[model samples]
Target chain A: MPARADATSPWRSVLAPSWSLGRGADPLPTFVWPVASAVLLAAAWSLAAGRFDVTVFPSPLAVAREAMRMAADGTIWEHAGISAARLAAGFAIGGAVAVPVGLAMGLSPFFRRMMEPFTEFFRFIPAIAMVVFALIWFGIGEASKLFLIAYNAFFSIAMATEMGVARVERSRINAVLSLGGSRRDTALLVVLPSVVPYILQGMRIGMGRAFATIVSAEILAANAGLGYLIYSAREFSRMDTVVVAIVALGLLGLAADRAFVAIARRLYRHTLPEEFGP
Target chain B: MIRARFVEMVLPYLLSVAIMLGLWQLAATQVNPLFFPRLETVWRSFWSLASGDLGAQILVSLARILAGFGIASLAAVPIGLLMGTVPAVHRLLGGPVDFFRFIPPIAMIVLAVAWFGASDVAIVFLIGFSTIFIVTINTEAGVLHVVRNRIRAAQMMGAGFWQVFWLVVLPSAIPHALIGMRIAMGAAFSTIVSAEMIAGDYGLGYLLQEARTTLRTGNIFVGIVLLGMLGIMTDRVFRFLIDRFGGEHAGSR
Candidate 1:
């Protein structure tokens, strides 16, 4: 039999300076566009807000100074940490439950029939609409906020998992079954392995949804977390703090997403190139 | 077989609602109206809201969503095409764009409130920003997915960069862009209510929030339903466009 391709072979190329644009490849242009766009936006804001002479539209410099002060006091970090914890907790809970349910639904028609309808129904309904119920079911606290994130995460992840499992080639399943493996064994050993790539992809997308939902949940309620911090800053008319929070949220979300992509590459080393290549 | 499949989809949906309403009706007999309103009374409220001033609020919310989504598509697609066709450009901006994409657009609500002062502009900005990220990413991805071999073929035939891009790349990327636009439209609509909740003089989100505060459960239900229906309708419109223009050439790579 032919030897299986070594998994570690590609990482060497990625890490080594084998590629022309190697490790020092700077995403500076990406940064510049958003920043430039933001500045242009800020300028536009100034012109528009300047007309009213209202304090709410503080100069961008004022927002920057307030950002620096929040950084000095470490208040921003604390709030960010709280928000991150909520995001992680929700992601963990939703991912764990949805993965298994997705596997079961994919494997059995009966389970899929019983569950898919209910899931899809709720899935189409906006997460924000569930805010009222979250407040009622879990009360106005961390649990409610976490549930909202979890709610967004679970449906997307489960559907991904189900689709992933279902999409695994029947040939692969038959190959395992022909080896005298039971249905359960073939599913666990053969189908599950192939489905990890899809699961990871789903999780990446879910991270986007969950991240967005968490902010809305926090805004609706909660005293801590980044959303709360920003809303508080707004109430105090601290445009700087608001700017900082906005930058912080954007940066944190981008970082988390990149981290997820990196981990996905590390996990599914062999298929990464062909699957995602542009 | 098609009939069976249709029944399979429809029956469960009907059953779930029946079960939910039945439980709600039963629970209302024991629970307080403020916390848990009667299902029948809620139905009555929904009817009134559907027929009254609440309908205008729904229109306001829908209009804002359409305006924001329309603006996002106009701005994002051209820039996305540039990034996708140019590797050097993609290499530079891809990293920063990916990072910020995750930051919940919700964080911008504060800035929205601060800068726009709870007006239509602020709401539009929030919707536009959220939709723009997804549209940009998808547009870029779609462009990348256009077969490199095809581009080379076009170039061999003396196609210029712009010609190769417009002829080969843009057509291939449309479906993905449309998909992203669809998702973004949904996201924009979802956020509109919340955005409106803050400083909205009128809109479904404002109305829903108001109904909740006023203890009008039925109106809240109506607002939620109207929003969902609008979302579904928008999705259908996008689907129709994709069918008409894209013609399944770019459905889902």
Candidate 2:
């Protein structure tokens, strides 16, 4: 249903200022709305936490205390560092391999045909299944964790790279070829520029998958990392610690995503598309 | 030409499978049978699962996936529409929602367990939560992209708010919503195995885990195959629905 910001509706009138929706200089009022919303959300959370009086549902204050405790004990930083390092490692490795392989598949029909079945089959196999093999192959160490993340990252990047290559203007390639450009030169000059945006997009996607895999792999079997911290907290019913870990996860994930987009925007300032998500 | 076209498509797939099986069979014979089951053994295992209690496990897993995916759509689509239609609301909620979207669902599994306990509801919620953001963003984009002129025209023509939304926004957004749902379905399926791995006593994931522990390579292989087949079928159904709606929408266009 189309929602009416009707004059008669007091809730709308009070909650949403009339002039905020207007054009030009009026957008400022609307821009500040989320601050009010943040306050409201926090208040609601506090109220619900208090009202419920549930053991698992720790109040915000309690979570803050737990956060402080973890900080004081120095375990939080250790776990956070471990998780971050793993994510970085996996993302770098996965991006490197996947982008190259994806480019190859996209540019070469023979390569695509050869790799298609393996990629499709492996794509369907859950990372958990790979963890079993990783444990067997890498012996339950950081390698296993990195391998899982790398594997997860590979598919997203590969798909994106293939898409980017497929979408390269055919005319541009033909023009380059007509100009006596070699295959390598055509790929470097014509294809790479067009595919850069998609490669970045694929990296963004791969980061999400890599992060997910890292956390899950860590949680499944690890002595260190934020995943292990949360698992440990859960084991002891330390709801506050668990909450803090989750909040940290949310923050890190958000930060990594924003950082990628910021870099992409900065690099591709001229040709950047406005709408992108997922 | 038709037969040749059919053969062209089929031959590559067959060749790939035959090569894979031949390699696996070689390894199975050379290596230990327990570690690397032969293709024939895996086929037998697949049939056994189809005929036995394994079918229930597959059904249970499918039910969980459907439940999670269904609930996510119900929650995401309406809210996405609201955000899409209202610029102010979208601006406000978009940042926070996007933040939550990136947080790996597995990271939240610990919280999910604590919040809802190790029950089916928690598993379903985890799967749903994992997939919701993609659907929300997609749906909102879909709705927002609905031609502004259409909305304005509807408003000008004595259409009420609801009527304008129903007549103009909903139809335009359906295609996007469907795409989001399809993607989210993939996400839901991707996460279901992990959710089941952690919390369930019975499911395809649970069965796969058991197979791993027992070193029943054949059974594990069978489980993996089923996961792929199930995922493909789920996608096919989603596509069918999209095409059905898309055809009518296309006619209008």
- Docking class for model 2 is acceptable
* Model 1 complex DockQ against the native: 0.36
Candidate 2: which pairs clash? Answer: none
Model 1, stretches more than 4 Å misplaced?
A1-65, A272-278, B1-13, B30-36, B91-96, B247-253
Q: Largest lDDT belongs to which candidate?
A: 2
Model 2: per-residue lDDT, tens digit, A46-107? Answer: 88788654457888888888889888999788898899998889778888999889999899
For model 1, what is the alpha-carbon lDDT of residue B6?
A: 70
What overall lDDT, based on C-alpha atoms, would model 1 receive against the true structure?
0.73
State the lDDT of candidate 2 residue by residue for B12-44, as single tens digits.
667777888788889889976765788889999
RMSD per model, one decimal:
7.6, 3.5
The DockQ scores of all candidates, in the order shown, are 0.36, 0.44
